[model samples]
Target chain A: MRGVVMYTAGDVRVEERDDPKIVEPTDAIVKLTATCICGSDLWPYRGIEPADHQVMGHEYVGVVEEVGSEVKNVKVGDFVVGSFVISDNTCEICQAGFQSKCVHAEFVAQTIGTQAEKARIPHADGTLVATPGQPEPELIPSLLAASDVLGTGWYAAVAADAGPGKTVAVVGDGAVGLMAVLAAKQLGAERIIAMSRHPERQKLARYYGATDIVEERGEEGVAKIKELTGGLGAHSVVEAVGTQESFMQAVGATRGGGHLGYVGVNYDVKIPGIELFFAGIHTLGGPAPVRRFLPDLIQLIWDRKIDPGKVFDLTLPLEQAPEGYKAMDERRATKVILTF
Target chain B: MRGVVMYTAGDVRVEERDDPKIVEPTDAIVKLTATCICGSDLWPYRGIEPADHQVMGHEYVGVVEEVGSEVKNVKVGDFVVGSFVISDNTCEICQAGFQSKCVHAEFVAQTIGTQAEKARIPHADGTLVATPGQPEPELIPSLLAASDVLGTGWYAAVAADAGPGKTVAVVGDGAVGLMAVLAAKQLGAERIIAMSRHPERQKLARYYGATDIVEERGEEGVAKIKELTGGLGAHSVVEAVGTQESFMQAVGATRGGGHLGYVGVNYDVKIPGIELFFAGIHTLGGPAPVRRFLPDLIQLIWDRKIDPGKVFDLTLPLEQAPEGYKAMDERRATKVILTF
Candidate 1:
């Protein structure tokens, strides 16, 4: 088996590694059909987050090759999608729709990298959801998307309460931000604004149901959103970019008593209490509980109601994982799907 | 008219000041029946907030003496309880139930000090909620409580979603925190945990429906809450102390997907983004949209359904305003009511 590993910052390698086997009675061995590099991957790759011989990739979709004795929900020879964070799913937290904080939760990226031929999935019954049937080859990309990015964007929109009669503004042009535009639209938002400076990304944003596009960043971006919403800012604002400036801009772009859902894993950012105090908005965010929305999102994708696969502008073979990382890190690709 | 004025950190004096006059078409002149010292008033009294012979107090229950042409909801001779912040109520923000952030909002404490014999309330129709009729002597303190502390606490409980089947933890021993306990109980919370070290406050907390009292502070307090909640933390947490520790404690005490409502006016506090991000909870806070809850609060007080006035442990005449301030500043009184 071959897997992607990073020995140091800015260094990615795809080399032969031990084939993963079922480690727990509830675990299943999955032969990954497809996986991808994430914007979060850039954090470690760009040295913003540490990468010391770390396994790479959390987003994946695959066929179950083998299952342990305790795995009931999913069995061998079934196509499935799983959340980035493994959970028991039956815990009080997961039952409350916060599977990401499941009592037995584990970050799959740090333990079982999916950018490989095969990987062991713990708590398989709770973490993996099988499609209605084995999805067609054409539906693979969108199914893989339900693993993280799309699910994260959906969580952001839901957390922001983006629905009918509301204006939603997404602050980030990344894959997650673009997917948030689609989520807000699907949730019946009356208007969607995508904040992006790049012409290409802006075009993609429009394709994802963004009714307006603002190129400005920070204060100017917030002002633009406020101006478009009759000086009240948007009714719902999504923060998908994990930066100090982007976080504050998202906060400022929400109307008073509005909802601000931030999904960006901000690092080293200190939220000024005074500003947030005066803003007086409702806020909810974190590593999204993707498992909560997977079943529905998979249905939308399977029904072809949404074309989320278009987010993958670049694709590469599994062995070329390094180039995929480089392409995404250099901003030459919005998202790069890796083939098996 | 005589009013309470703060000449410096420890210097308070009742001095004769010009009588308030209606300035805006939306203004109304009210003869104050009662006023009280607030926890926030201590900020300037302690010099944490600057005060230069500044008029003090924002809470009031009074008789309307005069009204400008546009004041329709409130009229002369009407007994009223008004919010600390003046709002036009009909504005988009106010209509959204965030009157504290109304576009034309102004802090009454900063502009029109109710500690005076009379106050010129701006946006009278919006800020002042006329009681059903003239209140009996006993209901005066409770009606005044609705002006800020009681209303603020109610907003906190509402914001935190303290309702049936939820565990609510209040992280402050102030009047507002105690009121939050009462509000949580009224909201049908399954359990109410009031964090307090003072024995007297604990007794008051029990009277307000706190099922459990935790004497611990900081990490110990959070630990006690988690232990009581089966290691998952509370479903709703209210932060009524405006300090970095209290803010973080409230965040720590909320379970993933839980709600945190904060109302303490923090002077120098910075929220650590990483901690808040990973906490994955919902938070809403600020000066509180007291006007949004004033009517219901007034009704609750009117019907004697809630005894919020019990929070005022001391009383002083208008000329003894200096002693009232000193008592609160010295922690000798939970709250001090001023009479004519």
Candidate 2:
């Protein structure tokens, strides 16, 4: 199997690797149909997060090729979607809808990188959600989106409690932020604000049901959001960018008693307790329990209720994985999907 | 009028001061029946927080001596329980149950320092909750407790979602933390864990329905909580101390998907974004919206359903304000009630 690996910063290579087989009774081997490079992937690619010959890719949708004896929910020859972090849904945490922190959580990227021809999935019954039937080829991109970005955005919107009569502001124009706008819209938010300076992404955000767009960033951006929401800030704010600036912007753009949902993978962020205390808002975040939303997201995608796959602006063959990584790193593509 | 003022660290004195007069149409003059020294007061008293001859206290239960024309809910001669922070309660934030961040919020400590013979409570209709009737003398301390600590602890427990089938862990051993145990017990928590090293506070915690006590300070305390919760940590964590150590301990002691409610006046506390993000817990804190919970808390106290006044381990005349501060600072008292 050919898999993507980053040997160093700005170095992505697709190399032949040994095929994976089910080592555990609950495991299944999947033949990748679609996979993508994530915004988070750039952390390691740009050397912001350390990596040495690390396998790339966590988002994946595939066809189950085989399953070990104990695999129960998913079996051979089925189209399925799984989360970035594999989890045993039976754990106390998982049962509470936080599968990402499941007691037996296993990062698929660490053990079986999905940006490859074949990958092994552990705890298949708990991790993978199969479609009603083998999904049409056209549905691949959207299903793949549900594996991470869309699920993450959906969770962010949910955590922010974006619903009827609420004004939700998304503080990032990336795929996840754009998807959060769509999630908020789908969740019945009366108004959605997408804070973006990019015209192209702004257009997509509007298309995703954003009622307004604020090009300003930082304090100015927060001011614009507050102005838009009658000087009280938005009822719900979704933070998709993990930097300190983005975190503060999200906090600043939230109204008192509003919910601030941050799904960004934070780096070097230090939230001052005094400011947060006076902010008088509810904040909930972390690595999103993506698996918890997979079933609903998959159903929505299958029914064409949402087109989250629109986030993938660039698609490349597995052989062109390096370009896919480069295009996203340089901000030329919101997301890059690699076909196996 | 006489009021408590901190001239410098370790220097508290009851000094003659000008009488407070209604400045806002929403203000009311209240003759204090009881006032107390709070754990947070120690911040400035110990010189951890800056003070330049600042007036000392925010908690008080009093009789409404006079009311501005616009003060509707509270009338002259009414026995009233008011929040430390006066709010209009008509603002969007207040309407959303976050009166602490009300657009017209006025910190009583800064405006009409409660540790005095009388106070001018602004936004009286919103800030003051009238008792069913003038209470017996014995209820003064309990009503005073409701002005801050008890209400704050109740808000913390509510934020943590303490309820049936949940295990709640309180992180501080102060008045607020002990009250948090009571709140959790009242909220129907299946088990309550109180982290305390002092025998007196531990006994009070048990009296307030704490099912377990963990004397270990930091990491060890977290480990003990996890051990009690079958290795997953408590279902709800109340952080009544705002130090970095207490914040981290609260986060560490909560299970994934659990809630962490914090309400100590934060001083120089910084939450590491990375750890909080990966913790996968819900975090909600701030200066608690005590007014939002006042009516219910007052009713509970009036009916003798709960006795939060027991947290006041010392009573002193208003003239001995310095000794009250000293006793609390020396850890000789959990709380000090100063009778005017």
- Which CAPRI category fits model 2? high
lDDT of 2 by residue, B213-312 (tens): 9998789999999999999999999999888999999999999889999996466788899999988889888888999999999999999999999999
Error of 2 at B72 (Å): 1.5
TM-score per candidate, chains pooled: 0.99, 0.99
Off by over 4 Å in 1: none
Chain A alone, TM-score per model: 0.99, 0.98
RMSD to the hidden true structure, all candidates: 1.0, 1.0
Against the true two-chain complex, what DockQ does each candidate achieve? 0.78, 0.81
State what share of the real interface contacts each candidate retains.
0.76, 0.88
The digit string of per-residue lDDT tens for model 2 on A1-340 reads 8999999889999998889988999999899999999898888888888889988889898999999899889989999999999999998899999999999898887767889988899999999999999888889999999999999999999999999999999999999999999999999999999999999999999999999989999999989998898889999999998888989999999998899999865668999888888887889998889989998999999899899989999999999999998998888899999996
Cα DockQ of the candidate 1 complex: 0.78
**Of the candidates shown, which would achieve the greatest lDDT relative to the real structure?**
1
Q: What 10-residue stretch in candidate 2 chain B is worst by lDDT?
A: B262-271
- The numbered model that scores best in DockQ is 2
Overall local distance difference test of candidate 2: 0.91
